[model samples]
Target chain A: MNAANSGSDMPAWLVIERVVRSHWSLSARGERDAGAVLLALWADDRRDLGEGFLLRAAYLGASRLRVIELALDEAAPAFPSLVEIYPGAVRMECAVRDVLGVQADSADSRAWLRHAGWPVDYLPLRHDADRSARFAAQAEDYAFVRVEGDGVHEIAVGPVHAGTIEPGHFRFSVVGEKVLRLEQRLGYVHKGIEQRFSQMDLQQGQRLAARVSGDTAVAYSWAYCMALEQLCGTRVPARAQQLRAVLLERERIANHLGDLGALGNDAGFGFGLTQFSLLKERLLRANAEVYGARYPMDGIVPGGVATNLSSQQIERLREQGMVLEAAVVELRAIYDEHAGVQDRFVTTGRMSPELAQRLGVVGLAARASGSPRDLRSDLALAPYAGLGVQAAGSAQGDVAARVAVRFDEVIESLRLCDLLLQDLAGGAIHAELGAAAAQQLGIGLVEGWRGPVMIALEATVDGRIRRCHPHDPSWQNWPALEHAIIGNIVPDFPLINKSFNLSYSGQDL
Target chain B: MLDILKRIARTGIVSEPQLKLADLLSERDTLHAEIAGILGRALAIRQVDAGSCNGCELEINALNNPIYNIEGAGIRFVASPRHADLLLVTGPVAKNMEIALKRTYDATPEPKYVVAVGDCGCTGGIFGESYASCGRVSNVIPVDAEVSGCPPAPTAILRGILSALASPRR
Candidate 1:
């Protein structure tokens, strides 16, 4: 993949050709013909750029990420919508329209992120938008697509829930018990994270990035730092790279452990919940003792990691990892053999491989339905490039398949961590980063435990952050959950939801 | 099922003896004296995520784990605010959720204490007062006790809960 010269003013067509020929390239094109060419490449994965309203498309196989700078000189702040070609572009375009006051030239232009919080004219992401201004509170009634029928009934759940969970509204149109359609309304957790990102310096940005989603803090921070390091042409030490891998795997283990527990609990199996929760708790304690923070919030900083693991700490983690493996192996057998658990899991909330592909489902959810796209294996960086990660996948896209994929990934992550710890390279934990070039853009992509997390970063000449967009795997998988819930009874929603375990705050940001 | 029973038998009551209220509760005697008559030894908590990073929520969930055994300490997380004696709110209040948070507070019966958990709950943490955010939990509703870690550890959360019970307002 050619790292296209930012200084070179390449024509839009040539830039597109370069990106198509190579796997990945960063090319700069003039404002003219940017939207037309990008609209031509509309079938590819395209996302909204920051407040500047540029369009980024990753053409060919999910490998090349190309950003097309839209000409803002038009009478109205509008760009051609890619929704006609790529179905996934609907929400991405709507989000940009909702926050940055950019419009997409397509129908179904209802707001996505803005939920009766701000005045219709106020755009929060714009530089001139008032941060402290308060809008009068009003009751919100979202126009959820109605299903008119003899037996169709709507059941609204959450934004707050029965269980202690993050807030999001789930409006289910149902015929008796079976769900006909499920529409989700989120952004109840949005805290203006993107606006806050611009207010922080390069180093401080990582701390804010880590909070994008607490569970995937390491993944988010690593991706943000990777983008910054790329802009500055800074290479992290080999040892630091290995340590980052270790921490990432540890995070994966902890989340999988917790999700497995919650899934069991949702299925009415209390024993599984207790056992798996205990396992997750032990791993978290180990994280606190060894890595400083229970969750590795401030662990990964720009140019490298914030903390270094001593040999003694490494030995302890390895021993604990082995013990965890043995325990989980035994637990898996019990979960598999238990008749009641199997009954609840099999064929429940099943999604076919074809539907999953059409919906662009990703991460563990996609792998369960046999999509077989894992960023660690596909876009291997650093230790993962040589580590040979075995992407966990299953042909069946049911609750059972999701659970099985999680189990397989947990085992794989444990093995990967052991290898990373044993082969600890000798070098400084962090490398001093040089000054970043002005008006430069860099992208960092990491396979977070949930799925792929991509961070696009732009820095000013003086090294202040211009714009940072942290894209969560939740954006791809949340719609998949709506599909997963179809044909299943209302009671099974919690179980099915836990299997995917999409992050609300991550997506809300 | 038999295997599960056998495993449980082998484990043989892994739960530690319930800690004395004085040991876990902050403001020990004051909390015991305040809640001893009305609430007795039991307290039902309803947790609200005003607008959090979910890090604080993770620690809140940790309270339910075997080590902490918050239930064993006579505090349990309830489903609805109507059933709760205390509201454990986490994050800075997002503008979108401000109404819902206030509604939850309104719905709760009298003698309901609110313990603001984590730094965000205490003072809005990193995402302070902004157009989209109202800063801290107190900015939206009255707070009884404030816990102040980026995500206060599970123990800190329990202490905060205990302190809320001790507050004379309750």
Candidate 2:
């Protein structure tokens, strides 16, 4: 078994000692206190573990995953909600209740994923939850918050959109064109991915992970594979690490380019869209030529990547990188100087740094809002550790801020791609990853283009995946989108939505 | 802004090589003539993502990009299903999304066609008939044309769109 140093280089504050792990095996009250102390001390993020309904929290300072087994067999499964400490835990708490039947004593628990499809008592992710049962379609009136005043009205948009985007219902409480409140309901695309993971072998689970969000396929697959490799004690080759980094950076550049164009289009700049879209198409075609998939789906597997690149392909990629950089820099100037775009973007959908902190906004959105937390730099995992990554950020946290962040990231990623290709080492791109040990827990966090994409894997004795929870940065950023639009006019909704561009499928899974 | 205009002038007509229907249609003899006759110079499409990974949606979106230049081919996506001539459905119809997909299919006028894009849409790719998923697009509604790829290329999706237009009316 290849144990390439089990996260030993993490900072001292980030380390959760073995004693802390055992401390969580406590009475419900003790668990609540422990969670409070963890949040107060260092924990920055929360994730719902599908196995045993375990609630896991992690830190960006030092790479540590603290699991609080909420459902102890001896007692009734209940724990004081972490919402008091980490307000971000509210959604995770509701999702855990909806999926795993573990209750968090939070004020708002109106069934997150239930979505009028599942019965009140039915928990989809529970081991004993009957799979054969069919749910007849029904529409339950979602209790959207009311804004009653003179000229106040409510506008409901989508589960089916006019654009070629995914499904998510958005309710806007508006006083004329100005948005008073914005509440979004997601989970229309929930395909039971967590339960599906248990049925597949470890390698198949990697494929499933990539599909969690197609745009961030490399991020999800890499996170999943990283978790599995750590669990099986497999050391990925240096060449594989280099290739994975290349793919990841490519994915980042591609998504950011597309988004930058869309954001431009949203702000009524068709010239920016056409120019940026042309540049982005070149990148996609280049990706298809080099990686064999436009989006890098299934390119990353359990042990390592699926394919190796020849030096000629590397040269082509480097050339494309140069072209893309020039085009983006040219377009960035256009975006900045254009009065129409600036007028719409400058203060529209403003989110203050303090509000971002309070809401626990994450990923690119968080970084744009003066939160300089980046997993690549903060958690310094391999390839990234060797090649120092500077986090791109802005203080504004508006549509302009997000756009600026994307442009900065695109340029940085292109530079990284060139470096990765130049520094490509010679070796096998894949390692032989064997069966995972029984009852093992593995966690992987990757800084995807949008933000941090995290995956927690648990394997059974027979090497089958016990449970896999692929968490997207969208989980944290989606609520920030709602908050970002509080004061913006209704017409500016599309522009704001495009700027953030949170994934419905990623969040739904 | 002046720089952008100058750049556009310098690189006159930077659009990628246009996709000819003849070359694409020659590969499939089934609906080549019929689709061309029916579609003429315009086809209004409405995209319904039943439960895709958004891979197919990205590719479908790519169809509208400058290089693919689908608009030049006289195909455009409409906001409303009622205004659509074809329904381009992607993803492995999830149980939750089944009714919505059907409602969309039913909402479209009688002469409309449904083209299932992506392997998932065609045959429920990886996440197959499970408790939460209803498998392929055909499982929920009749699919006239099946474009098979994990997420088919933009050219292939366009072909699927054409084939569905040419498909026999039920």
Top-lDDT candidate index: 1
Rate residue A107 of model 2 by lDDT.
38
For A43-108, candidate 1 gives per-residue lDDT tens digits of 111133332334455421343345544433223566666555455557777787777777777835
Per-residue CA lDDT of candidate 2, range A355-388, in tens?
Answer: 8877767789988899887777776777888777
Classify candidate 2 by CAPRI docking class: medium
What DockQ results do all the predictions give, each relative to the true complex?
Answer: 0.72, 0.66
Model 1 segments more than 4 A misplaced: A1-53, A59-69, A72-74, B10-12, B16-22, B25-34
Per-candidate TM equals 0.91, 0.91
Give the DockQ (C-alpha) for candidate 2: 0.66
Given candidate 2, what's the lDDT at residue B117?
A: 91
* Candidate 2 chain B least-lDDT 10 residues: B25-34
Provide chain B's TM-score, model 1.
Answer: 0.87
